[model samples]
Target: MRRKEDVVRGVAAGIAMAATAPYLTLKLLWLTGSHVGARDPKALDSLWTVNLLTFGMDATALALALSFVRPWGRRAPAGLVAFPMWVATGLLGTILVAVPTDALASLVLGPEHRTPDQPHLDDTIADWVFTLVYGGFGVQGLSLMTAFVLYARRRWAGLLRSRIGDLPDSPTRNVQRAFACVAALVALAVAGVRAYWAAGGEVGLPIHWVEQRTRSIATMDAAMAAMAVAATVATLVLVFRIGPGRRLRGPLTVAWLGAGSLFGWGGYQLVAFGTETTVKDLPSATPGLMNLVQAGQFTAGVLVLAVGAMALTERAVQREQPSSRAALSGTEPPRDLAAR
Candidate 1:
């Protein structure tokens, strides 16, 4: 059973790592390009490639998440609420709002339209798509961050109040807390920026015109990138702390893979932001970076899903073993049955 679990975790981790490579490479290419034209044939090709990669990653995440249901004793009430909210926000904001806006803007405005310029038919549609999709993603991210923070806080409080003496803080606990905080902050910042844009107002009051507008957005992007890097590093450190042992190997391995996914995804977010922001003639780099970040995030999401799956599987196996279940549950069999 232990060996089987390890195999399952290893395969999942390998798939996640493989998914990140192309996505990351494309992002780096765009970032370093002397001139990256969004409408350029090459840029479009890169975009399609990233889309394909992310599709695969998302599929994997869904599969892994499904696998966890049996053992986790069905989805927890909290997860039930949180997961749907995250998915809905992601779909609505990205597909419904952001994508259409960006596509219309590109088609009608010939890829050069600025806000308030009464974009061409195609440009207008594109703008609407971009607004909703990106906005949705940002909202979804905020929701997940909030959920994770609450979960971590609960765990921390339980640990502190428990009778388990000499329980030193694990690296996993510390990293998880750090990630929760960073995720929450990123979500807040993104939300604030979106709100500012929605109100037909830009940040950096009065000096909003000229280079300041671009600079202010760039600064926010940079800050997000830095936090992502920190989170990735912290997650990796936690991964290395998984000790070697037969019985403990499966869960540890799954957790490690999940951490790796987080690291890759977080790192990619930073790179994608840098590439998009620094590109010349780019409308803010958000569009170009979308697919890349999605790929990384999906990959990380899969690993986390795998962790849940392993936990569920363990629970299922335990239930099947009546002796183990009886011991843990403290339920004794009838004396007559025992005698028989």
Candidate 2:
């Protein structure tokens, strides 16, 4: 077969990259007080900090997008490709799916119930600013995920041939199932908090930041918890071989991505929360709420991470079949070669 290049996919990735430009530009504009997309002057205290973190995320997405068409991406270290992709899938997956629902709820329930608003969390950006930023994130996530699928399929087509139910029986499988069960339970609890918060209920462990930025934290908590729930459920279903047998690749993919994203998002939040912020110094007389969320999230992350590691390891060490053995027979196939 003649080696080919995916020009169409490359174009798609390029378009996604272009969409991010305006969002990043607007974020930079906030620092200069251009207020291009704002109804009010920026009020978020950690403007630079938030922008800096988001800038890195966009840059990583851009790099992943470029890798879809470039030679280096195919050759990039697996960890390099995996880490960012996992994060993108985890964070953006829920947001992309929920944005419209959230907007609808916000419209119907009224602005007061949209999310628990903090003292000044969103005073910095206008509604349009978020539309652009989140829109860009959604696009970038979809594009990167597409690119990765193509890249991974081209690179390791044989590895994916096996389905979830076909996973070999081993101690690792049992361990993974245990992890999944615990993760599912934790995710369920977290999801309750999220659902409550999203519904405009005050249920989180009261902290100064939660009180100040109730809506923002609530939104995040709700979203993260929900995503974790989906991931853990998918993982457990696959682990137990409940519905789909070895034939179902779709649930397997969901389990993999959901679990990975759950861990990635959990780890991201744990680190972000652990880090000292400007809010730490503010004076507050309210007795701090017993915040188990941070610890719970971290624990859930560790379990999910363990589960993912076990699954990936199992996939890696599975016995190779004839087709895969032949494909790996010392000849480098063309970069764009499709699996037989």
Model 2 score (lDDT): 0.64
lDDT of 2 at 90: 72
Candidate with maximal TM-score: 2
Please give the lDDT score at residue 333 for candidate 2.
Answer: 45
Model 1: ten consecutive residues of lowest lDDT = 158-167
Off by over 4 Å in 1: 1-42, 57-126, 145-217, 224-262, 266-340
Cα lDDT of all candidates, in order? Answer: 0.39, 0.64
Per-prediction TM-score, please? 0.31, 0.76
lDDT, candidate 2, at 220: 61
Q: Where is model 2 more than 4 Å wrong at Cα?
A: 1-5, 28-45, 106-122, 205-222, 277-291, 320-340
Q: Could you give candidate 2's per-residue lDDT for residues 1-340 as a string of tens digits?
A: 2143375577667876787788778766765556576545534434566566776777777777887778887778766777677767776776765675666667777665334444554555667767677788778767766667767667756556656566667777777788878888876776676676666665443445455554444566566666767777777777777764455466656765666555665566555544443454444322222235545555676687677667666655554343366578965544322332
Clashes of each: 34, 7
Worst 10 residues of 2 by lDDT: 282-291
